[model samples]
Target: MSQPRATAIGFTAVLLWALLALFTVGSAPVPPLQLNAMCFALGGTLGLIWAVATGQLSALRKVPLPAFALGTIGLFGYHALYFAALRNAPPAQAGLIAYLWPLLIVLFSGLLPGESLRPGHLFGGLAGFAGAALIIVGGGTGFAPEHLTGYALALACALTWSGYSVLSRRFGTVPTVAVALFCVVTALFSSLLHLMLEETVAPQGLLGWAAVLGLGLGPVGLAFYTWDIGVKRGDIQMLGVASYAAPLFSTLILVLVGIAEPTLRLALATVLITGGAGLAARASLRRKPTVAVSASSDG
Candidate 1:
């Protein structure tokens, strides 16, 4: 596919992810691990069905074991931390902090062989962290001790996802079909963890079940497949900048649904985070020709 087309396809994942926080909140009362198990199971089953129907089952066989392992760890670790974060902290705050992955992706991409870190990238990182600090410190009221663990987990969630996305570039030859196996393994792992650690509380009512299904079908399911294609083949830097939109849309969803209130602090933090990502993106774009050459060569 053309680069622009792939990038556009990849951006769809961002749009889908905008609903992640909302669906996650709606799926609540169900423990994190259990929620992870349920959503990934549905996602995995659907992915496998698509693969079979498209006659791509043989393509999956070509994917290396290490790739499978990496994909599983990324998917499982990210959602587990995210689900737990929202449960422990206020959803809007925690979700914003976790959304730092896009900025992190921009920063981390500088470590790629042909990409050079610029002053703007460093400054952007600081700005993004400042925003996160605002969230954690509760707009200068000092640490919200009760939510520290959740904030910390959200930070870790950002790191895990950014690392996964950057590293996935190295496996550019791997077909997106392999994401099905990743989802399957993640489901199994989540199920095991839920069984061992979490009490089984089923989703409460129609809204709850709808949330789980929404997650599986949209954010958790097809998002991964399209993202795999985008990051592996499309404009990664562009996607990184575009990702800031997810948090904005996510928080808006929460507010509209009455799940969270729109506050000055949230708005300010969103500005900081989005501004930081834009700075980093500008640096990346300045060297776009070189980066594109390197990406093509690497792929």
Candidate 2:
């Protein structure tokens, strides 16, 4: 397919994957390592399939090893910290904090030349954080001591995500299939760790096993592959923008399941988040003006 069309679809795929991730949180209560192992095991299979189908498996070894290693380490770090934070903090709060990854990305992006935040980004970041705060504070639970600890870990998750984003950029031009292969390899290694350290592989019967595989094949693997494709197709900006929808979807799921309830404060927080995100997205959509005029730009 043409690049533009591929990019547009890729953004949609990202939204789907993010949504799947939100739902996958409470689907099964297994240990995070076991969950990662299962999901990644599935990811390896799926990634291998795509690689073979695309006839790119032969070139897979040629992908820069350092970049792949960084990506792998980034993945491992984010998930481990995230699982640890979940031990202490409510998942909703922890998840919300983790969602700040985009903001983290924006902050880090400034360090790199040729990438600067625009007015839209400022507005979006504010709005996104506002939404996150709503999701964190308004989720009908008071903050516990563990919550604070978890929040710290959540911040680490954000940083790890930023690291992955940077690492992935090194292979930004690489095909999504290749990236998927690297992720699959990372998943395989993580799964092996699960076997060696934990004596894991919970025997929760078929349904439990299904959840594990779903975590891996569906959200972890399939969704990620689509996302990689989106990145390679040059829709990272759009994909990034749309990804702000993640916490909102996740929050709604929790609320619907009675895990969280809505309050006036929560409502207000949602408004701020929505308003800010809307403003930011609109701002980002505006065209950049010529260098002749930098004194002011409404967007």
Candidate 3:
């Protein structure tokens, strides 16, 4: 696939991700496990229907069990930590911490075959981290001791997502099939967790139900499939740069929705993150020529 097309797909996925916190915050009454279970269950059902229609359901049986297991755990684990992070701390702060996965992806991309860690990537990542620090410190909450658990969970969320993306790339699989399996696994695990650990909390109104449906159809389902394809076939460096957009978009959306107020700290964070991502992606300017494959229909 050409870089531009793949990057577009990745961008769509990130755009959906920007709405995640807004929906999650709106569903504050719902437990993470229950939310995860409901969203993934809906997503998995959608994916299954798509797969069957596309004749990909048969391919699922051919995928190795280990790959299924890894994909499932990765999908479930990241959200589990992320949902906990949102519940434990202010959504904006916790969101920034979890967004660190992009930088981690850039750094860890070096572990994959033929990929190298470049100086621009490292420098940009540091700048982004500095920006994140500004947001955390100046974000009104000011590092309260009570929110430490949220911070920790957010960090784990970053690690889990980074690891998942890198590992998914390292192990090639059919994107649709893998995503379907992972969603199913996540739904099961989250259901179990909900049953064992959470009290029942149902969506109360139109907005609440909308949040659940949007999350199910977008972030938890289609977004993951697109992301898998992007990371596997798209320019990894470019995706790294594009990913910072997620947090920027997320924060802006929250502000628009009145969940958060615009602040100088956020403005600076946007500049820093955007600048850093541009610098990091600058290395992609030197890519060697490759055959352009049409990826638009692949999904």
Reference-based TM-score of each model: 0.82, 0.79, 0.87
lDDT of 1 at 105: 81
- Across 233-258, the per-residue lDDT of candidate 1 in tens digits comes to 77676677667666666767878989
TM-score of decoy 1: 0.82
- Residue pair clashes in candidate 3: none
Candidate 3, position 247, lDDT: 66
- Name the 10 consecutive residues with the lowest summed lDDT in model 2: 290-299
lDDT for each residue of candidate 3 in 116-139, tens digit (9 for 90 to 100): 677777777777766765654463
lDDT computed for candidate 3: 0.78
Model 3 lDDT at residue 207: 81
Q: lDDT winner among the candidates?
A: 1
Hey, what RMSD does candidate 3 come out at? 2.9
Worst 10 residues of 3 by lDDT: 289-298
Alpha-carbon lDDT of model 1: 0.79
Q: Candidate 2 regions off by >4 Å?
A: 1-7, 17-27, 88-93, 111-113, 139-150, 196-206, 232-238, 254-270, 289-299
| Strongest candidate by TM-score | 3
Q: Is candidate 1 or candidate 2 better by lDDT?
A: 1
